[model samples]
Target: MLTQTLPTWLPRLSFAPVNTAPRGDTLVVVFLRGAADVLNMVVPHGEDAYYQLRPSLGIARPDDSKTKKEERTVDLDGFFGLHPNMSPLLEAWQSEQLAIIHACGAPDESRSHFKAMELMERGVDDERGPASGWIGRHLATLNTGNSSPLRAVGMGTRPQRSLSGSVPVSALRSITDFHLGGDLRALQQMRAALETVYAGDILGQETLSIMDTLQKLDVQNYQSPITNYPDTEFGLALKQTAMLIKAEVGLEVSAIDLGGWDTHFAQGSSAGIMPNLMKDLAEGLAAFHADMADHQNQLTTVTMSEFGRRASENGSLGTDHGHGSMMMVSAAMWTAAKSTGSGLGWRKVNSLGQVIWRSQQIIVMCFPRF
Candidate 1:
């Protein structure tokens, strides 16, 4: 049999020069790939305009006695509520661990997913900003000296655009399968040969780091206390992310993508494709929250989309790409006292009635620890 090297697509474990000590909370960024219709996800039942605009696709108010429990939105506040399928997140809300920023999104006027996403990830409004990703730029500020091979990770085949920069990031599909795939004997021999050939060199150091990470992630002992993941790709990704955080392998930042949010057609209100996606997102996030309960203080999860859907329902019973979406921030440390009444310099909308969809800018809520 011909000997084969590791696949080219496999992430290369390398390190960037560190300046300051690694400090700060672990930031887990969840990108809702398709522009999620935040208007529906976080229903603004208080606004008569919302209902009037979204006639067919409008979610019923939380107090709507006529709708089924699974059909009506779960009221978060007097005005805003979550979609019925997103009931799983109510626990976080009630616990004061989650904060929803309504009518938030990038200021870019481009409704194109690619352009908006690129600009958002790059953390720039126009073409004048640096090419590096926001997270990557943030990582550049940290001094991660000789840290674990997995400092920053994107839980997918390709690294998320937000993680693109001077920092070395690993884009992984499956944590379990992240290894030299082939004959065991050949792998062992190649490893030994490489160790000898690059001993005391940077390559050798990175190789040793990879080995150490693999050893730490010994599949058997790293079981999560919370196991009820939805068996979807997003579920698995969150599960693995929790596992990685639990392992404490210097995971400062992790980016996970949950696609299929572009509800251009058949976007039902009470029941349909949107609800199912909400279920997956809620369940997966809830599972992750449960699994990482112990590390709640150290974990902060933020969800964002490129842009939001149009305020008005289209003729196709769906929504078109529009401005002013919402971003969700969940951190066990975010108390009502800390987040309430404090605008953190970001524009605050007291109610859905006050939200100016056209002028709304996506606010990147950075916690104190972040």
Candidate 2:
């Protein structure tokens, strides 16, 4: 259950958000905090160079007879394969609900975790750019009639920099914390007082409305009837986000974090530390996909990392920070090229830094229903 207690007086800075129909699907951005190894995550098994460089760390080919099932890659397109632990997503892959964008990343070329993440989150080429995030700008500009105070949410302690624009975003931890002392009379009295104090302000009204919205939800006790979600922090976050969406609380975008991808030490190839991380990720995602089965076409979940680790495994058995990154979109409405699997055109490149990281359309391109 959600445990953190946040003040209901979270800040917001915005003018009137034009009330209109939804512009698109609810977008959930899952940020893998530490630089993730996209090469390993989305294994390029057909590329011999991948195995040549990191023989010890590369996942075994799908057809490798001697490799354990847990160590072998789950064939996607013969060329690209998902790490074995991520096999749970095969449902989405085969169902054509998952689109993998390879080698997409910030062109800043900074390997420092903090700098790279800042640049990526801000959607800037370098440090001398706008402080607000791309998503922030999107929400600010789009006159989608989503007026729910919980419209844009940062799922943890602080809002992600990408959600740092002018349109008000709520930095929240738990919906349960807003239960208002668990005393109905006190809650009514407090609500009356707050309504009286914030009577004429738009932001205040929105804030009060958000409280009212959350008050009706039972998020902390939510349990998906169809999916047995993993009991991890990431899983719980996704679970609660699903609850908010189902409650129709006007949650447009949510930024959830799953850190510790900086596998500089003991970055397991198929069965160790890295695979464990992938298991947690895959299980949570699969469960979310199942739990939200009813709202398939209305939601889009995307995964990203600050940057990708080096292609070749280092002497320390882990990869170094590099520019190779990939993005994944799991949506029932994937409208991009019917990618049968090839790493070019709609691709993003190897962390080896040899291939040019050319850009291409991903989000809106695939968001046709939106």
Q: Which pairs of residues collide in model 1?
A: 105-362
lDDT at position 103, candidate 2: 67
The whole-model lDDT of each prediction reads 0.75, 0.75
Tens digits of per-residue lDDT for model 1 on 212-241? 455445443444555577888998788778
| Ten-residue region with minimum lDDT total, candidate 2 | 6-15
Query: For candidate 2, lDDT tens digit of each residue in 60-120?
Result: 9999999887679888887898888888988888888888888677776657889888887
Candidate 1 weakest lDDT stretch, 10 residues: 337-346
Cα displacement (angstroms), candidate 1, residue 14, comes to 21
Off by over 4 Å in 2: 1-24, 179-186, 198-206, 335-370
Per-candidate RMSD vs. true structure? 7.2, 6.6
